[model samples]
Target: MSTYIRQIKKNVWKWKNENGIFSVKKYPTVEQAEKIRLIHKELEYMEKPFILPIIESTQEDFIIQPWYKGDHTVSYRFKEDRKAVHLLLSQIHDTNKLVDWEDSNLFYSFNLISKWQNRKWKMNEISFFIESHIGWEQTKFLLLCGDIALRNMKPFNMEKRTLLHGDVVHHNFLSDSSDYKIIDFDLAVIGPREMENILWMHRVLPEINYDIRLLIHEFPHLEKVVRRYKEAMMYPNELYREWLYAYSLPKERKQKFIEQLIPYTNKALTEWPNLCYTLSKL
Candidate 1:
């Protein structure tokens, strides 16, 4: 039987053939393509097998790589896989190799918070979807978190900022047998170590449906810092990025993934503040 790759989403695919499992994704620019190449190199240097090897595509359409055959990105078995996830992250985070990119990520995260007042989309129905579920107060707190993170989250001089995976959600974690590997680098950026950890623990972890208390207990030393960072993450910049990406697509191609987006927003708002309150007392 002839094996074929199936589309997982626009410009993304998963399939297995006679050779092995693989995935392909479109790169918006050559710079992105180069960045992925650089990331793969760094991962190899780290002696980590978590990153999937890139398969060069002869055409200019998409970047191809071996698909992790073990499992897809999911939230279950977090406890069992958490250690491997952290280990892989530690290796990647420890690298000093710099990819060519500016440090506008934090700015971008909170930029909308300040400008939302003047944003034409403030009254747009999409905004209503977010506000209705999260409430104005929760919204205000999130923006506040953005403000604080923008102003206060700084790089540690001891451990210089380095390249980060950018998107470290639970699903990026692939478990092959007993080991775990990470996939996706299109959103990679260079930032402070603390910021990377903060972003993962605050934003990505929650999105993956992790229990905030368990996270706090797992890393008690980082509790205060994590909470502070979580507060600053009231507005996840990634959501805006995703919406912009989707909006740029043809109407027929846009699947209104916002259906999932709003609930995630609500989940963050509903849980974060309560977690903050709990953390404060502890």
Candidate 2:
């Protein structure tokens, strides 16, 4: 039932089982694994019944997978990023406008849902996901892959139970000459838009460098694709702060992240003309 991939990459080990695609992740320790799982359970409660790749106690490590559709990855560029972004956003925006999340999620009561526990909030037991006190599960947990850097947008909606490319990132799409297919579903979940995904209209694509910076500058309207996803993000201010603190590592790591993020922000602000500072205080 299990097909193994030798020489697995960093944290995840991928394989094929009688069931489907699977992965194994080696956490630093059992405590780390438990912490992450607890956080994820809360995330599931917040969103739809998020069915992630399950965790298994293997002889050697923890195993999981995002439940892949079919195996595939490609290195070629799509014929057009602008066209893809526009087409995808237009379709999604029209769709989202029809659905109201507060009304939709009202059907699910809070008591039946899982809540964060196990950790004490007492003075002795406090730990943080960030220096500012975000919790790992609570921090920037997008209902969907809000990070447009990577994509395999086989669209699917959690509440509607319709699957399409959920993400519309440039690279998520691949065209073998004429046909196109999505490749990643790591962020898929089943719920309404707010809890299932932070679909936004002004999302930051993970493009770096002066060339992309220039492209974003010259074609400012193209940023609308990024904005389209930003529009649907549903994080409340408190949860947003909590999630950041939860996942924020030590000072060195935070420094590294800030280094990587500021430039992206600067570039985005340039083309966007009215970009909001999500992490300004941090």
Worst 10 residues of 2 by lDDT: 111-120
lDDT by residue (tens digit), candidate 1, 111-162 = 2224433232433334444455457776565555444444654334433566
Indicate the residue-level lDDT of 201 in model 1. Answer: 63
Residue 202 of model 2 has an lDDT of 24
Regions of candidate 2 where Cα sits further than 4 Å from its true position: 1-4, 7-11, 14-79, 82-171, 174-178, 190-200, 204-247, 250-253, 270-282
lDDT of each: 0.60, 0.37
What would the TM-score be for candidate 2 when compared with the true structure?
A: 0.34
Instruction: Supply the global lDDT for candidate 2.
Output: 0.37
Total backbone clashes of candidate 2, pairs 3 or more residues apart or in separate chains: 43
Candidate 1 weakest ten by summed lDDT: 104-113
- Cα error, residue 256 of model 2, in Å, equals 3.3
Question: Candidate 2 at residue 259, lDDT?
Answer: 56
Q: What digit string (tens of lDDT, one per residue) describes model 2 on residues 110-152?
A: 2101211111122113333232332344222321222321232
Judged by lDDT, which candidate is best?
Answer: 1
